[model samples]
Target: MYIGRFAPSPTGPLHFGSLLAALASFLDARHHQGKWLLRIEDIDPPRSVPAAIHRIPETLSAFGLEWDGEISHQSNHHLRYETALHQLQENQCCYYCTCSRKMVAQRHAGVGYDRFCRTQQHTGGAVRFISSNAELIWHDAIQGKRTHAPASIEDFLLRRRDALWAYHLAVVVDDAAAGITHVVRGYDLIDETAKQILLQQALHYQTPSYAHIPIVTTTNGQKLSKQNLAKPLDLSCVSEQIAAALAFLGHPLPESLLRAAPQAQLRWATEHWSMERIPKRAAMAWPGV
Candidate 1:
């Protein structure tokens, strides 16, 4: 069976950009007659808002984006992340780094880690995965063949000095463990795909197919995100929101369907969803935002 997931970090309530990802993932899964799973990416407790754990699902439900099986939370899967880290450690692909962000910035003026801690043996600090390969590349379903520059391909951290599992490590581990066959997400994460692929290779996990939808940005060209203070979607206008999301994906719905119920709108979208119609760009300006 084709298994797909919509993993949202509970840092804030769902916004327009997040709805685009959720709607795309949900429609893709339904179009393929596959199971759509929901996972709360609450690994970073400090950054997570307690209310979002409830609001996210409620918002998805309001938008008629129902998920299959029990919702998985990353916070409950510490053992799995630890096991994956240990596997990387056993493979000699992971190293302990004592360098802080400021330390690395001061040493390397360019992008990514400077590999200063690659030689130095540290006991307890951040754990970084060594990129043995010179080039990291992958084929995105939407953007086609993509390659990462050497500057972007560095020894990324698996675990932070703060003891939190890095997003790359946890995401790769969770996707592999949950048998996710397809990943439909926003394009802002396109750069991280290479790092995730590298981690999958090191951990000997099957790399799932990836389709990155264009991210919704503000008129100022800033990506819509919780950090950017993007407003949460108004559930009262669920149908309109769904229609707008579909329109943003290059599948504009008829005016009649814009006022329909959430389920009806999603039904029309799923039946007519076309991966080819999705824009290949990384970002698009959200109208009237």
Candidate 2:
């Protein structure tokens, strides 16, 4: 059976952006007659707020979306990540770099890492993995073939100065470990796909299908992110929120649910989910309903 996930960081309430992602993954998994899972990506404890951490699951339940099996948290899987890191190290694919942020930026004007530490390993610095020969020539099941210049990226930190596991490392490891078959997420993470695919290849894990949905941008074309202080989702209008999300996917609601409640709308969504109806566009401003 196919498996997909909607993993969110606990940094804020379940806003429009989060709702869209959750609905997309849930509906897509149902469309494929597959199992959908929820993962709490709370590895970065510094950014994880209490409300952000607890309300996501509650919000999903309120929106009438349910997942299969136990929910996974990144914080609880550090041992597995450590094992992966150790495996990469054993293969000599990753190296340690003690260069400070200021030093690295001074060398390359804030481009990707300059590979200074690729050869000269350092203690008490970040750990970075070297890239493989093949990249930029892969295709995502949803987005199709994509290309990128290797020089566009540097050996970014897999482990940071404070010894926190980087997002890049934990995500790939988690997805593979969880047996995810498809990844339906926001377009903001599109670029990360290459890095993810690269890691998948390095670790010899199967690359899942990737579908980057349009982000709920602002009128000024800015993405609705935690930093911009996007408004929290109005739980009071659950039906409207689900309808808006369906509209974003380019699958207009059938007349049957026009007067139905939020739970009804979500039920219809799961029953009639259609990947072909999803908009192929890369980005669009939120309808702001």
lDDT of 1 by residue, 16-75 (tens): 999999999999999999999999999999999999998999989888899999999999
Candidate 2, 112-230: lDDT as tens digits:
77888887857557789787544477665555677887566457678887889999899999999989999999888888888888778788999998887888888778888887888
Q: What C-alpha lDDT values do all the predictions have?
A: 0.91, 0.83
Give me the displacement of residue 125 in model 2, in angstroms.
1.7
Off by over 4 Å in 1: 150-152
Candidate 1 C-alpha error for residue 144, in Å? 1.0
Evaluated with TM-score, which candidate comes out highest? Answer: 1
Best by lDDT: 1
- Candidate 2 lowest-lDDT run of ten: 133-142
